[model samples]
Target: MGKLTIVAHIKAKADKIDLVKSELLKLINTTRAESGCINYNLHQDNSNPAHFLFYENWESRSLWQTHMNNKHLEDYMKATEGAVDEFVLNEMAEIDS
Candidate 1:
């Protein structure tokens, strides 16, 4: 209904951080171009080479769902099926802000 914010914490396979970054960044760029996207960004952990995070904002839950079903996103997921070792996706809403 309201805005949806998605936070994704991922850990690439050993020594595959760069590969994951490249692919994930491409998907994030494409997601930013989507009609309902509010913002999209990727961040790396300072101490952990294999850890990365994706922060994304969308107009609504429905729009976020659409982004999840995007062709490019699907392709990215397929490509990283084996390359990715761990993933944690969290969704949220701003309670007061």
Candidate 2:
């Protein structure tokens, strides 16, 4: 019922970095426009070009789940099927001060 933070780490296959990065980039604008999306940011590892991370915050878990089932997300999964080598996702709740 509270805010949700998501940390998603995606590592592209050595030969598919560009493809993966581009596909990942496609999610930003669309995701940012989604309801309940507070922020959707993407980051690439400085030393590892093939590594990517998405830092996201949503108003609620329900909304975030809606985002996960979106068409664009499905497309991204299809587009980057074999291009990614590793994927990890973490969902957390911010500690109140």
Candidate 3:
């Protein structure tokens, strides 16, 4: 099976972005050190400072599932529960790229 791509589009209060982004960066670094993580990244939208994106890749869907159950990931989510106004998660298949 191919890698699983997870795109987390997060939009929080204008002032909360720094907090959210910092938390996401920790998650990304932790994820990258996991057993099956291929890559993990956090990015901010140039036009919308309050908007952020988390791009993560796992070796397999099972690995991704494992990541969801990871303590760090759970802790991160719990810490930022209501800090966001909009949280959109998207799973993607890399057709050609």
**Top lDDT prediction, candidate number:** 2
Query: What are the Cα lDDT values of the candidates?
Result: 0.88, 0.98, 0.86
Query: Where is model 3 more than 4 Å wrong at Cα?
Result: none
Q: After superposition, how far is residue 34 of candidate 2 from its true place, in Å?
A: 0.3
Q: Please, what are the lDDT tens digits per residue for candidate 2 over residues 53-74? A: 9999999999999999999999
Q: Identify the runs in model 2 with alpha carbons over 4 angstroms from their true place.
A: none
* lDDT string, candidate 1, 1-97, tens digits: 7899999999999777788888888886678899889999999998997898989889999989988888998888877877888999999998988
lDDT for residue 61 in candidate 1, whole number 0-100: 92
User: What TM-score number comes out for model 3?
Assistant: 0.90
What are the per-model C-alpha RMSD values against the true structure?
1.0, 0.7, 1.3
Over the stretch 1-97, how does candidate 3's per-residue lDDT look in tens digits? 7888999899988878888888887886677889998888888999998899888888898989888898997888887888889989888889997
User: What is residue 23's positional error in candidate 2, in angstroms?
Assistant: 0.2
Compute the lDDT for candidate 3: 0.86
Ranking by TM-score: 2, 1, 3
Q: Where is model 3 poorest over a 10-residue stretch in terms of lDDT?
A: 22-31
